[model samples]
Target: MDMFEDDTPGNAPEFTVSELSGAVKRVVEGEFAHVRVRGEIGRVSFPRSGHVYMDLKDDRSVIAGVIWKGVASRLETRPEEGLEVVVTGRLTTFPGQSKYQLVIEDMAPAGMGALMAMLEKRKQMLAAEGLFEASRKKPLPFLPEVIGVVTSPSGAVIRDILHRLRDRFPRKVLIWPVAVQGKTCAPEVARGIAGFNAMTPGGALPRPDLIIVARGGGSLEDLWGFNEEIVARAAAASEIPLISAVGHETDTTLIDFVSDRRAPTPTAAAELAVPVRGELLAWVAEQGARLTRAQTQAVETRGRWLRDLSRALPRPETLTEGPKQRLDYLSDRLPNALRGLAQRRRVTLSERGALRPALLRGRLAEEGRRLEALSARLRPALDRAVTAKREALGYRSDRLSLRPISRDLARQKGDLAETLARLSRAGEADLRRRRDRLGAAERMRETLGYKATLRRGYVLVHDGEGQLLRSRDAAAAASGLRLEFADGNLELGEMPARPVEEGGDPAASKAPTPQKPAAKAPRKPAKDEPPSGQGSLF
Candidate 1:
């Protein structure tokens, strides 16, 4: 019956044990506003309302736990019986049932189990999303101008990426620095990727040819951000080809599953970013050697062809029948019949001996005569042959000139007319573009016009030659001029004269004021840098 004291065990108070338990719970609840309990889950139940009911137990005792529907639905993994759990909750007593229960705000399985459960849950979720599919992966571009990197700013991952990309091909690499761990990290990583995309000139992001999302080697928990659904979705949704390098060769993540390519390490990711510089150089050198060898081969082939051609052709003088005819007659006449042959031989021998002198004299005289005749005939024949050949060549050249080098020039003319028409159409299109640009410019000018401000209240004045008079010095001697106000413009009348003592008197002067000899303005130098404008002549 006493509030603070215990009575004898057998001769107990009239109140039930449940009543006492409820009373004790109420007292403890009033004493402690919030409490954290570590225990093993005894039993678990989920209801249609989305609430979770579980009993938290120790070796000797247990207490009821009520997880609200909203919080229960958000848990990555469901509570199971016999699992050790840590719960932050408030205690309250139910007076009607004379029982005590905990209303849990947040809960988690204790130690390694919690992490393993989370990892397994994430793996299942991403798997269900088909993030691991190979069909979704895109091909990496051969050459890229800008490559986006999502990683820690100060880490070796970024430095490795930069060095690798520069080594492979010197191109710009944009970095999207992000938090890679803790509760807020997944969202931050996701947002960083989106931010990189948003900075592009078009609605599309800079669209780096490749995205290298990398981090140094770490334990499974340390690389957990890459396993998050947010990060996985971000990688999957990226337009750029993504290479995920989350952990060591043994470790993998959901981001790796969704990425276009996966590398075992951060350095390997860099390797994926660009080709090896030494290999490229070696390839270029090999190509150069091949080209040189090819050229050398071509030259040798041409030289051999020339030698063969020289061997195959005959000399020019041997081409006609003049030498062959004389040789043939000598061969034929020397072998004739016997009787005639003897007489012919004797006569031929004597005759040949005697006739040699006469023949030489005759030949000399005939040669001289022939020479004289040739000399006499040479000028006219040469002139005639030359004139005939020249005339023939001229006629042929004229005929060739008259022939149409280009087939159907009339048709070409018609085609040219059509082309001109097409060009005219193209010119009209260009003119329309220019006109659009002019209209846009005019609209912009109107939009930014100072005249609008001038209409509010403004004035502009000009001298005789329409030069804007900016200062009182310009207005000093100027008389005939115009002034424009917001409303309208008016021409100015003759101004009053200056005092004679100040300079020259106007009205009292008898002769017309000698016009101050106007200084001739200097001529602009000609921009006659020759031949630079010719497109191909230079």
Candidate 2:
């Protein structure tokens, strides 16, 4: 063989890590499909995930066991360290860890011996806690008016109890049906006991006076539910007196130790709950007869004693004779006492009548003096009242706030300023409007007046008194003629009226002849002169 022979690739088979692990898992699970493992529990773990993990081991070999969350809660007996248990489940492998484990579907104590050992151990633990103390037990009622029974309704235990109770004394019974075996038994029984105690007294449903937790005879394994810690504590904590009749005389449970009374059987528990009705009625009748006889004897004894005491006492007539004589003595003196009282009252009335007028005058004078004194005090009192009122007014004034008045003043000031500004603006606007109207009227007057003609090389003739001279006759008859031009006025000397003969031309004769004529000068025209060379309208 060549040395490189081992280096050559060979065609054995192709396999992945996951495929190999899966094949191994299938083989292990198929071979041990369902198994019952018997071993002592070594380690117990209850993680927050609710699944239970434990180690089941023999002397040498150990196996990891897992109870899923769902199955863990339904289990009757929870796994504990050092407890021998038989677990029923299938074998499975975890590919991630590459190890095999048992998935526990059901679990129980390995045998009767294992159950007894666990029970004894639990018993000792509870006994150390004072739960089994006699002081914790309550006294059973003499004859409970209402009885609460906790048991399976379909079971023979409840029927036997009812029959026994009826034969003895019929009572109102409240039945709280509960599971009596398996995983549900412990919690249901605990709840039943607690429920009976939680009822309200004198309510629509009367609260039971006593509670009886009963079950039919069974093996220790079957009755193990009563031995649970919850059932035992519920029995110890019951407020109502409880009678435990869980099994036959030979059977014992944790409840037997904590309950107030224990009966050998359910029927015996019923007997303990109530008294026999016929016996009770007969006893009551016998007590009544005895009481009646005692009452009659007592009456006769007291009557004889009263008779003996009567013989030693005085007679009735003798007792009244002394009182009658005393009453006659008192009646004879009453009229004399009344007459003496009337005489004293008459003497006192005469003395009071003699002094009536003087007493009235003295009273009037005293009253006048008192009135004057009161008047003297009244003015000062009034003055003091006024002074107090003024001080109070001053104090209140000091406490008054000025901010509101200041704010009002500021607001009024602002309003006044706004009004003044509005008035000023209104006055300015009115003045501007009036000025515009006035300017319009002035322009119109200039356009329609004689001064417009005077500006265009024409003049106006007026008399010295400032009246217009329309014709030459008026000018000649005036003392003086004034030539008015656009720029200024020039005065002419007095004009002589020429004589007009009746036939000569009157127009020529009316022409003026002034002693001294005013020389006219051409005045410069205004800036707004008409177009050059335009003839004057005059």
- TM-scores for every candidate against the unseen true structure: 0.44, 0.53
* Per-residue alpha-carbon lDDT of candidate 1 for residues 379-482, written as tens digits (9 for 90 to 100): 47655765675566556555544234234446657889999999999999999999999999998976556454457676666555555666565675675456
lDDT of each: 0.70, 0.83
- In candidate 1, stretches whose alpha carbon ends up further than 4 angstroms from where it belongs are 1-28, 31-33, 37-85, 92-102, 166-168, 197-205, 295-538
Q: Please state every model's RMSD to the true fold in angstroms.
A: 22.4, 39.3
Give per-candidate clash totals: 0, 0
Residue 40: error of model 2 in Å? 1.2
Q: Which candidate is the best by TM-score?
A: 2
- Whole-model lDDT, candidate 1? 0.70
lDDT of 2 by residue, 317-353 (tens): 5554565566557556545655565556556656677
lDDT of 2 at 81: 83
- The Cα error of candidate 2 at residue 208, in Å, is 1.7
Give the runs in model 2 whose Cα sits over 4 Å from its true position: 1-33, 93-100, 314-538
Structure candidate 1, residue pairs in collision: none
Q: Worst ten-residue run, lDDT, model 1?
A: 529-538
Give lDDT: candidate 2, residue 292.
97
